[model samples]
Each structure stands twice: as structure tokens, then as C-alpha cells.
Target: MPGGRLSRPDRQRIAALLADGLGYSEIARELGRPTSTISREVARNGGPGDYQADRAHRATEQRARRTKTSQLPTATTVVEPGYGRNPQAAQDFQEQLAALMVQTGMPRMAARVLSCLFTTDAGSLTSADLVERLRVSPASISNAIGYLEGLELIHREPDPGRRREKYVIYDDVWLRTWQVSARQNAMWADTAELGVEVFGAETPAGVRLEEMRQFIGRLSEDMAGGPTEAAINDALTVTAALIHAGRPRSTAELATALDWPDERVTRALRDADYTPDLIDPIALRRTESGAYAIDVRPERLSDVQRAALRDS
Candidate 1:
């Protein structure tokens, strides 16, 4: 029954569950069917508010009769020779993965297209191939392809010796997608910073904007793979060692003090130089003796302030 079409009794139970205010997952649990199946059934039969068991059953029967002769064969199953894999199980897993993607704010059609491309042995599919496999209209495939392409999740390549094009998912698709998200987060942070300036920082709206700017800015930095917590902690520890010594110390000396390897100490020092915001108002300086020392001078001070201090 898990993989079979819903029976008339199942539809009646779905209707009853809906009338009882049970959600799709709850109804699916009661019927021992996949949640996607329950959701699709309700969606195709006037939705939860208007769904009727008899009408839904009739519609399903009519659709089956109409599409029986035209239904395309499914070829998305993974078949590894001698692997003892069940093709139906593989296909069901693909569908469940696509459903999970849909729940994560992805468009349903786009999720299906992506899942199909991912599961295929070639990791590529032409428009016609997608249409045949998905049994959907060409327009729907076209729209889904455009959405995926816009997000950098897929790319197009000309089919060799053919006029049609193929959509491809590469091993680096997730990397590219992550870079896109990092860029978008940076843009959001920039916009929020601008809002802070326009609304005046003391105002409530500006306060909210500033919070957004800080949170998104940090998120963008992390996504960009800048300065891990371990690196930051190491840098802080090195800085503390320098302060405790009250004098410039060589990398070897700092390493010995902290019980760290010289390479680790050197890497920590480099990270400290790269991300100075964590220990602002204090500077890490290389003394003429070729040793590391802490400078209390705020290097971020304005030129005028620096000149004033120099004059003083």
C-alpha cells in the first residue's frame, strides 16, 4: 500500500482527517502513505477546505484513464550492477529528498528538477529528457530550469550535434551556491548599514537596522570562511603571552610559553594580523629585534588623531 495508488477508502479517510483538522503529515501517518502523496491528493482535489472523497476519487479515475495511454516511462532509477539495490527504493528516496527540499522554501518544480538531475548517472538532463522523465509540460520544465540557473545551482551546455541544450549539475554546484549566498548576505548587510545611516542611529528603526547589519555582517564573514573560532582563540592566547612577557618575544619563545608548536604559533600570529577587529584598540607589531610585541596604540584612529598624538 505504501507505493500503490490510494484506494477509495484511503480517500475517504483523508477527507475525514481533513475535516478533523489533521495536517498532511498526520493524515499520511494515519493512512501509512508518504506525506507528499497526501499533500498532492489534497492539492489536486480542491485543497483541504473543499476536498471531497467521492469527487477526488472520480477525478483521479478520470485522470488515470486520460493519461494511461500517454504516460511516459520513468528512467530515473539508479541501477548499479551486482549492487543488490532496489530500483523502487532508490526512486522513492529521490522523491523524499525532493519533498524535503520543497519544505526548505524551494519551488516544488525546481526541487523535482534538481533532484532528478542529481540522481541521474550523467548529472545532466536535456529539456526533452526532463519532460519525459517528469511527465510535465515543457513550460514547467523551462521555468524550473530558469529558476535553478538563476541561483547558480545548474548550468546549460549545448547538446553535442543537436540543437537542444542540457542542464548540468557539477560537483562544485554546492560551492557555487554557497558563494552566491555569501554575496547576497553581504548585500543585505550593506543595505542594513545604509538604513542605519538614513534612519539615524538613535531612532528605534535605526537600532533595528544596526542589529541586522551586525548579525548579517558576521554571518557573511563566517560563510566566506574567514577566521574560525579556534584561530581567533589562538591569536588571543598569543597576544596574552606577549602582554605577560612585557616585552617583544620571538615565535619560538611564544610557542614554548604556550606549549604550542612553532608553526601553530606562527599561524596564530598571521590570523591575528588578518582579523584585528577581535582585539581592536591594541596592535600587534614586529619590533626591530624581529620579535612580536603588543602596541597599545589604536591603529584604526583617524589620520588627524594620529598626527595630534605624534605632535603631542
Candidate 2:
């Protein structure tokens, strides 16, 4: 019965997911069917672009009726509901969430996984649970989990009692996405600024590039935690101390280096939302040697370290 004819809701989900930019393979995985099933259905229903849920369902009913004379009865099985979500409503919501995630640049499988976790009451799922619920392969679940983790949408929590780990979405997950998006904006701004110099700032191409640089730089500043003039001025005394320290320092380091109370230095970065210790827009970078450096080139950092600077 698992691979039996798809229901009307299933067709609706397929149509929705197609609109969300999911490929056939991803749809099949989500619906617990073979890839060819979706491929054939889509092709027969006017291809991906024109496929409509209501039309597809009507076509399927017509086809079944046409073959009714030759049909034979098949055995059936009874199963109880595993969750409270109404089948049709749940599938519809999943499709919509998947579409939104796709628009935000998440791959279909990863979107499916994150949406599943987000909707659950616990906001968590083990890899095995994902494979079973999505009716996908273990490898597919693994890959999707990894991708979501990379996006900071989910994290792995060790469950020693069950001897399995669960992937979880935190309350601040949306904020983390903003952090990653801001860093990406910064990267683009840097490239656009470089383009302005290459094409001459007065040239048409350079002018366009300059506009891009300016817009993105402003976005990056907001992402980097913009503080008011009054806020910056208030923290100026402590912030100035870090500048002439002659070396890179974290909160603890700065406190020790300047013989100031640890909490005072810690509070400056938190309250002022300024650089050198936190979101260094134009100041320091972590070097290959694992030290925060003002002059040294940036190193390819781990996801954890990159998150500290702003998400990767």
C-alpha cells in the first residue's frame, strides 16, 4: 500500500513542491515513492510548468475509471495514525514551508527536513526518525541533516540514554539565518568594491558596482549590529583601550592585558555592539595560527569560529 496510487493531497503536494523549485527526486523522497512515479505523473499532466493539482487528480480518476473493467481486487491493510496532524493539512503546510525555504536558497531535501523539525512539538528528530517519517534512505536523511546544520537551522544533540543524536532547531534559529545572510552580503560587497576600482569609478560599469557596494555595505553594517552614536560614544573609553593593546585579544584577554575587570570588558562588546572582540566589520580577523590578528590574513575557519565572527 506504501507504493499504491497517490491521493489527491499527494498530487497537491507535488504541484506545490514543483512550484517551490523541488526536483522530481526530492519530491519522490518526500512522498515515499519512486522517482519515475512523479516523473510520469508530471509528464502526463502537461509537464512541470503547467502541472496543476486539481487537473492532475481529475486525470488520474479518469484513467482509473477507464481501466476499471480490467481491474482486480488487491489485499488491504489497516494502520493507526501516528501523529495528530491532519493528513491533508500537514502535507499542505509542509509544501508551503518547503517553498518558502527554497526561496531563501535552501535545497529541497534540506528544506523538507528543517520544515519537519520546525513543525514538530519538540522541534527535534533523530536521523532514524527522519528517514522513517520522510520515507527516504538513511543516506538522504544524513545529507539533509548535515546541510541544515551547515545553515545553522539545526544542531545535533547527543542523547546518551537512547544512544542516538537528535537534530534540533533553537528559538534563535531565525536570528542565526540573518547572521549568515549578513556575512554573505559582506562578501558580495567586498567583490563589488573591488570591481569599482577595476572599471574606474566614473565609468558606467563602475558606477553600477559602486552602488552595489554602498547598498550592501550598509546592509552588512546593520547585520554587524549597528549601534547609535550615543551608544558608541558611551563605550569609547573601553573600546579605545583595545585599539592600542598592540595585540589581538578576546574578552578575557583584554581584561588581563589591561588589568580591567573581566565583566567590564565583556559588557563593552555586548552593550556597545562594536568591533575587535565581536563582529569586526573592518578591524581584526582570526588568522591561520588560531589567533585573532589585526594584520594577519584570515584563515579558513571552522563553522563554530566563523559563527563567532558572523555565520559562514
Candidate 3:
């Protein structure tokens, strides 16, 4: 299990269980562990953590790693190994990766599922595979996969010869994710314009709301005007090369960076995507160095668009 990171207290209990003469298989059955885990645990900690549950648990984990190292062959092999085949290594890696992903703002179960998926060579897994991989229920796998799909981090594909569907990580996952973000921004701009209608443009409340709306709207337009992703990427490559070469930017300097004109660059910055305030288009202004930067995150409402709500 992905979700099973034995806490300090849990490890302490396991140590006590082992001392009671419970066999490794029995302890695993009682603790819902794979038998290998119980055997490894007792072998790792030099038998106990001074009887303190927390201290003993940490000691056990540290010992496990040392013990594992001793077991490896001195010579490296061509095929390293599937993590799952090495019970402790797989368990520790999955748990560690899951914890890191959660710290980065992913939900716990979702992170665990993602960790397992990434670890596999397939770049995909059926729901049953997820359930087995994470030791989670079918429903839990379904829910996590749904959230991953919503984020465009994963998508479902048919499993040939099998009735069930497999969730897959797309080859162009990052590009597809970026497109989803852009589409969302465009939607927000549309809502902002509607807000101006709901609150009459002349009213104080309406003015404030409209200002917010216009800022987002303009940002959306600016994003739309920016060079297509391929062009932008080429520009980034040239920019990086310029930095490495220690060269200054000139009009002709950037012309070779991308085929786009200076005017297009100017308009792209004014794009609502670049300036949330819509208060000052000047913020979108280019520098003499030909670099463009924005002071704020482009407006895409955090809350559901208020304009979507119909009047009673």
C-alpha cells in the first residue's frame, strides 16, 4: 500500500507483536502487511526501538535500508529490477513519492495512484492494476483516475481484448495541460463580460466588477494573440542560446528568434492573460532588451464565474 505509511505508533506496535513470539506471517496477517514486510521489519531494527514506539519505528526504517543494501549483489545488472518485485524498496519508494506529491498540493489517494502509475513502464494501468498497485479499493482508483483525467494528467483508453478501460498518460501531456489552462482562461473572460451586464456598467459596484472583468477579458485576448506554442518554444530556445552566448537583443536580434513582428509581441503582452488589473495596459509594455514580463497572474477567476448564475 500506497496509503500505508506506517506511523511511529504503528511501527512500535509491530515491534511489540514480534517480541511476543508472533511469526512473521502471523504478524503480517494481523497487521494487514505483506509477509515480507514483517520479516524485514524485525531483521532491520536490531530487534527493538528501546521500546519507544516512535523511536523504534524510525530506527526500524533506517535499519531496513541498511539491511537491504547488504542484500544487493556487488555487481550491477543490465536490468535493474521492477520495484514491486523488491517488496521493501517498492513500498518505501511508493510511500515517499506519494508523500512528496501530496506536499506539492496533490490529494493523498490521487498522489498515490499517480506515483504508482509513473513507476510502471506502461505509462498506463487498468483500474484493477491501480487497485492492486496501491492496495486501494476499486472505487478509490476510479475516483482518483477521474480527478487525474479532469486535470488532463491522464486519460482513459480502451483496453484491447479486455472489457475494462485503462488510464493512460499521454505523450504530449504537458502541451495538452497547457491548452486546458488556456481554454479555462478564455471561459473566464467571457464570464467577466457577462458580469458587466448583470451589474449595470454605470453603477459603482458594476464599475468595480467590470474593471475586474475587463482585466481578465484583455488577458484572454493577449494569450490568444501570443505566438503559437511551437513558435513560442523556438523563441525560448533562441533566447536561451542568446543568454549562453552573452549577446544583447536588437530588433534584428529577435527577428531571428521568431518570425513574429515587434507589434505582435507588444499586443501579446497587453493580452488579458498577462495583466489581471486591466487597469494599466502599460504593464504589458516591452523593455529595450526585447524581453516581456507580467507583474501579475493572468485573470482566471478562482471561484465559479458569478455571471453564470441567472437572476431569480
RMSD of 1: 12.6
Give the clash count for model 1.
0
Output the lDDT of residue 308, model 1: 96
Better of 2 and 3 by TM-score: 2
lDDT by residue for model 1 over 32-120, one digit each (tens)?
Answer: 89898998787655567667999889977965774563445753444543213654445455656676667667788898888888887
Those runs of model 2 whose alpha carbons end farther than 4 Å from true positions after fitting are 1-87, 223-312
Candidate 1: residue 119 lDDT (0-100):
82
The 10-residue segment of model 1 with minimum total lDDT is: 75-84
> What is the C-alpha local distance difference test score of candidate 1?
0.79
Which numbered prediction scores highest in TM-score against the true structure? Answer: 1
The C-alpha lDDT values of all candidates are: 0.79, 0.69, 0.60
Off by over 4 Å in 1: 1-85, 227-312
Top candidate by lDDT: 1
What tens digits encode model 3's per-residue C-alpha lDDT throughout 176-294? 64666667776775576456567666768767766776666555545555546654444444434344545444445455555667655323332423432342321332233434333
Clashing pairs in 1: none
Top-down TM-score ranking? 1, 2, 3
**Model 2: colliding residue pairs:** none
RMSD of 3: 17.3
Supply the global lDDT for candidate 3: 0.60
Judging by TM-score, tell me the better candidate of 1 and 2: 1
- The positional error of residue 15 in candidate 1, measured at the CA in angstroms, is 7.8
